[model samples]
Target: MPSEAPPTDFSVARIHETVLQMLGAGVLPPVVQAGHPVLRQAAALFDGQLNAEELGQLIHLMRSVMRRAPGVGLAAPQLGIPLQVAVLEDEFDVDPEAAAVRGREPLPFFAMLNPHVRPSGTASVAFYEGCLSVNGLQAAVARPENVEVDFTAPDGTRQQRSFSGWQARIVQHETDHLHGILYLDRAELRSLSNNAEYSARWAQPDIGRARQELGFLPG
Candidate 1:
């Protein structure tokens, strides 16, 4: 005998119920609105002189805010402190085709701190960027397709590396956050409004796919 498939309505209802329960439990924080002083202020650099406890506190604060927020990235300024640091997680790996596939690899999680970016290679424009500090808004922005950045690890180890595509964009975006710039500041509002007529897309997601034969899922 075969089992029956679950209904989509039931699935959505269960997810909604879980979210409501979490909200009631105080796992989420009220989103900070636009024009907040912190959101507008430029962050300061990590003094390179923080003790272990101080560094630990910064990390914890960033993690806590990120966990409670819907945005994919956040900066120290959003927390009312101006500091040259930010944290992000790339979680947009939704592929419709993968639903019927046997196996798909997962993307790794990362945290970048005090990152400095240089326009070493190509530049490109990406659209539909939103930020935790600036909620309820998105804009099309132009950025370098590739960049080289230097920074210290969370453990204070110095490191420099080059990145391309989405990685580069994420780094650039966070770097701007440290410099007191929001996505709206660099937004191509005119182009974005007319994007339907003249579309120039950005964002490259499939660089490290475990399988290439799998096609993209329908939107």
Candidate 2:
């Protein structure tokens, strides 16, 4: 018998569609959680100037796929590229569609080029967070309820903004990816999802508002 060829990995487009189909079909494949080598590797920085043309393309692509999948957020790593950038729900409390609906207004999409965060005050403890990489699994990660974050805008203009609640969580989460750290590595894995002998699923410094009360936190 001829040797069987290894199954071809799904294309990003196919994976994007599959995620969408699952959403429409009401069956989401457990996202490949941490432990995958891709998730562990540190992502490279975006040195190329993401001009209006490139930024627009990336934003459009991310938004399109994100809607099809109906996720609260999606990172570059999930798409198989190790770029230090991501797009997420800046306003976690609002309906996910709102980001699209609000257009470039109050709830416009966030395109972070190079992000760095600094905390100014004590962070509130909350729980309930999930990762696109870790499908079907969720955890409680403590994050600063509020903080000052400085990052480069898609326009290449430097900007500093203070965000709290769900917004803060999204920024922090994506930044961690740039350093090869997963939410699970930064969340309080031991406290929230503890089982007798097994290792915890979350990391430390978990203080985002993805806690149970948000009611919009993704799984």
**Residues forming the 10-long window of minimal summed lDDT in candidate 2:** 1-10
lDDT of 1 at 43: 52
Q: What C-alpha root-mean-square deviation, in Å, does candidate 1 show against the real structure?
A: 15.7
Clashes of each: 5, 18
TM-score of each: 0.65, 0.63
Candidate maximizing TM-score: 1
Which parts of model 2 have CA positions greater than 4 angstroms off? 1-33, 49-52, 90-107, 190-219
RMSD vs true structure, all candidates: 15.7, 11.6
Give the poorly placed runs of model 1, Cα more than 4 Å off. 1-31, 96-107, 191-219
Using alpha carbons, what is the TM-score of model 2? 0.63
